[model samples]
Structure formats: structure tokens, C-alpha cells
Target: MSESFQLRVNDVEYPLSVDQGRNLLGVIRTEIGLTGTKEGCDDCECGACMVLIDGQPVNSCSYLAVQAQGREITTVEGLAEGDELDRLQRNLLEVGGVQCGFCTPGMLMSATALLAEHDDPSDDEIRIGLSGNLCRCTGYARIIEAVRRTADGA
Candidate 1:
């Protein structure tokens, strides 16, 4: 049964009707029209569908939409403030962390949560934080550097 629910996404409150087991990924991308979050391994093996649920990274592909009611969610679209890009984004570009870009958004979101918890994450922390996200394009060195740069530069 679909019921009324309010989901605060990217700082905007959206009224929606979602049933249990309705994937948050579809709601965010199709219903809400925020496609920055990619769908990879639907089984949660790939971190491409990552989003921040109340400031913590979660794989939206398997997360139920109804579970997000009354909670804050942040997609890749929320990383920027108008024209100013988040430091992680800037560093990603500057450090060549993005290549094919399929995994960029997830990487950025995961790194955002990591940096939020640890402003200066060590190399191992960056690796562990990004372990869920897989990037076949740029490898991981650049991505790790980008996160490190963003955290250190902050």
C-alpha cells in the first residue's frame, strides 16, 4: 500500500507516496529526476548507487524508499552550492580522478561522508572508505589523491 511520505532530498522536502520494498534509487532517479546517482550492481556489490542518508553513505539500489521518510538524503546533486562546486568535486577534476565518470558520483559521495567523519583521512582510510566504489577507468590512485587533496586542502 502506497502511503504519504516526506523525503528531504538535497535540502528539498518532497512529498511522495511509496510502498515498502520500493527502491529509493528508482524514486530518486525516475520520480525525482535526479540521475546523478548511477545504478550498478543491484545486489550492492557495486557502490555506484550510493547516496548520503542523514550524512552516511548508503547503497540506494537496495534501500527502500519508505525507509527514507522524515530523513535527509543527499545525492550527487546536493554536492554543489549554486555555481560553487564542493572541494571534493574540484579536487576530483583537478587530480584527474574522473575518467569515464560512471563511478564518479558514488566515489564523491562516499568520500564526502568519509571526510565528514575524518577531516584528514589517512591513505588506508581513503582506501577503506572507497572500497565499495569500483572505478575501472582511472584506477584508484587518482581518486584517493583527490579525496586526500580535498580533505587536506579543507
Candidate 2:
């Protein structure tokens, strides 16, 4: 039987009825209409479905909807304030970090989590923090540069 749960997504609370084994990615995309969280490998490898769960980055493709109850879930849609973009988002654009844009959301979520903890993370630390999120385009150099730029306030 399906169960009902509340999810705080992108700073909005949504009461949804989901299947017993529904994953957060599917729920977010299909139910809540948030398409930023892409489903890549669905095995927790690609990190394409990354989202912030209580300020921590997680693979939403493998995370159950029930597990997200009462937690603050942040998606790519939440990174900006109206017309203003987040620092990382702006840096990504300026540094050419986005191509194809499938992995951009996940990359942003992971980088956001890292910045939340370490505003001045080193390049190596940024690399390690974003190791799980993969990008087929841009070669990840630009993405890394974007994160570093955000950290450095550039």
C-alpha cells in the first residue's frame, strides 16, 4: 500500500502519497515536478540525483522517500534567490562548468554541501568533496574551478 509523507523540498513543504519503495529522485521528479534531480545510474554511482538531505549531499536515486521525512531537502531549484543566482551557480556559469546540464544540478548540490561546511575549501578538498558527482562534459576542470572560485570569493 502507498503511504503519505511530507517532504520539504527546495524550502517548500509538500505532502505526497508515494509507493512503499519509491525513491526520492522519482518522487521529486514525477510527483513534485522537480526535474533538476536526474536519474543516471540509479545505483548511487553517478551521483546525478544528488540532493541535500538535512544539509548533507545524498544520492536521491537510491534514497527512499520515507527516509527523507522531516528533513530539509535542497535541490538545484533552491540554490537561487528569485532572479539572483547562488555564488556557486554564478561561478559555474562564468567558468563554463555546465555543459549538457544533466550533471549540473547534482554538481551544484554537492558543491553547496561542501561550501556549507567549508567556505574556504582548498582545490584538493573541493575535488574530494565532488568526487562522487560525475560530469561527462566540461572534463570537470571547469566545475572544479567554479567551486574553487566560489570558495575564494572570486
Choose the strongest candidate by lDDT: 2
1-154: candidate 1 lDDT, tens digit per residue: 8877888999899888777668999999988889999998888988999999999999999899988888899999999999999898998998888899999999999999999999888999999999999998987999999998888884
The parts of candidate 1 lying over 4 Å away from their true place are none
Candidate 2 lDDT, 17-130, residue by residue in tens: 888699999999999999988999999999899999999999999889988999999999999999999899999999889999999999999999999999889889998999
Error of model 2, residue 115, in angstroms: 0.8
- Distance from true location, Cα of 3 in model 2, Å: 0.7
By summed lDDT, which 10 consecutive residues of candidate 1 come out lowest?
A: 13-22
TM-scores of the models, in the order given: 0.96, 0.97
- Compared with the true structure, all predictions reach lDDT values of 0.92, 0.92
Against the true structure, candidate 1 reaches a TM-score of 0.96
The true-versus-predicted C-alpha distance at residue 47 of model 1, in Å, is: 0.5
lDDT value for model 2: 0.92
Candidate 2 at 64: error in angstroms?
A: 0.3
Q: Model 2 has how many clashing residue pairs?
A: 0
